[model samples]
Target: MIKVDPDFITFEGIFAMLLSIKSKTSCGPDNIPNVFLRRYAESLARFLVEIFRSSLSQGIVPKDWLIARVVPVFKKGDNAIVTNYRPISLTVSCCKLMEHIISNYILNFLDERNILSPFQHGFRKGLSTTTQLITSIHSFSAVIDKSGQTDVVFIDFSKAFDRISHSKLIFKLNLLGLPSTIVNWIKSYLHSRVQFVDINGSHSDFLPVNSGVPQGSVLGPLLS
Candidate 1:
């Protein structure tokens, strides 16, 4: 006689399905997986734009029209603890994705608006400052003589997460053509309840009703 747990059936079914799919004929780069990836990227971009709009609606515009200017204030020490600090750690792959989205937004914004001159001054200054900072700490040259006197600029958004509008995010998700099932999954995953234990061994349960996506989860970055 064999004993089987109900959980085994679910796990084995999923595993068998995945194995069958893998064993089938190879789908080239232009297959369903690639299509899904592109769709996800588009959805993520829409989500980010919604976040930016929400921030603006809440009167949380960029302070200096520069992203580098919005630096975290941290003490220069090993044991220094900054209260309420949530450091974002991104892999090189994630950084590249962010860069792509920001570059697209800048180009689109410039194309739509003829207000480049006014924005160029701060942008150039911010770029120079950023280049200097990057080069000063790293062993690299700060100045780049690319093209003929081309100016660089940077735009930073301040208090980005603090200003994220949950409702607007849902609207953007819908606008991006994400299925309701997926949207509901995201909302439930982000809004799940959690129990926390304090330093004094006191436990409290709380639900993040209006929080954006969690930053530190294994699948969080991929979903974002």
Candidate 2:
């Protein structure tokens, strides 16, 4: 995961982040919508900045921010198969704005240090699965052109996100040289998180989220 300087949460920064929110984003368990944030960004920026600063300074996220609403989205395969669906977590919009800012800082940190491998084509800006696939094809074609057959092996981990250990993730972040304050703040953000599955106007009992970053969060991909 990337690191951030909590000081980056300024009035202008918060205002810009609010404006960046897409109107179509679904509300989290807090029932706060993105369009409302964009509409009142000017009026709300100051208060949000204060709250963000306090949260970072104290190393404690607001309890409400830790809650998520999980919506299961179907993927290819039999509809009856539970594994065919992926959990899309909807979190508080205000909390996501802070995440966006922090993620940008972390990206900068990684870029400046040349920490991310050049071959990494997923998640990073300007890179995607399609790009990686194209690169692989080109490499294979070039090799075959010279009559040098290429052997390729693909491996996909099942429930990769669900298997991540929070303690180990924290340790990896520390080894990456992130500041102690930022690390502590991330710990607070990860722990005590609770979520309930929502489907067709029905909600399940709130379950404690102990491990793995949920999908559909600003920091989930970055953290993974």
Candidate 3:
């Protein structure tokens, strides 16, 4: 698995993408399209790989990867209602392929002064930090409120790791305008190489586990 910085995936790139889309298209929070945001996030992750690949290929490993021991930490924080998990091994190769396509082709097209590269420098850094600050403040405010009126809920799904329906996922991919060839490749890849370890020490091997696919994967959240 190609480990990366969890912060990079969660806040940095995501916040930047949100701000960019909002500014360019005037899609405010109330008007933002969920599907569009999903695609944007996937694209942003791919762009990040390009920024790091030159260094990676030169034998300069990413420090985050070395420290984390996983591609990125996929967490369901206090606000999360559910969680999912997929083996890192199954999706890393596909994510790399997706990154290559975005960096070499999509990014190049954007750079031609026609397409817009979503990696708009200062915005990412600024928005990322702002998001962290806002989240921290909100959490603190919730705790300090004199009234115990704040409410929180968490939902956990059973067999979440093994519940994906490949056909449904493929349909969603088609809706997202991904080419059939790429979609097919993803389906085959997911179906052919996943191994799972259960809580009871039992092990199973199959196409990517259906239920608990990794939410952090570039494609997983999009498909979900």
Which wins on TM-score, candidate 2 or candidate 3?
Answer: 2
Per-prediction TM-score to the true structure, in the order listed:
0.34, 0.92, 0.33
lDDT of 1 by residue, 85-176 (tens): 45332212222232333333333444456534532322332445566566544432323333334354556655454445666776765565
Q: Which residue pairs does candidate 1 place in steric collision?
A: 66-156, 67-155, 67-156, 123-153
Per-residue CA lDDT of model 3 for 1-224, tens digit only, reads: 23222222334543344434433432211234544655566665566556444433333333222110122224455433334432343233223333333233323433554433343321232345567567656876877795545565657875443477777776765664543444544555354334333323343443334433443344443344
- Candidate 3 matches the true fold with a TM-score of 0.33
Decreasing lDDT order of the candidates: 2, 3, 1
Candidate 2 per-residue lDDT, tens place, 59-162, comes to 89889899999999999899999889999999987788878866776778788899999878977888899999899999999999999989877899777777
Query: lDDT of each structure?
Result: 0.36, 0.85, 0.41
User: Poorest 10 consecutive residues of model 3 by lDDT?
Assistant: 64-73
For each of the candidates, give the backbone clash count.
4, 0, 13
Q: How many Å off is the CA of 35 in candidate 3?
A: 37
lDDT for position 136 in model 3 = 57
- Best lDDT among the predictions, by candidate number: 2
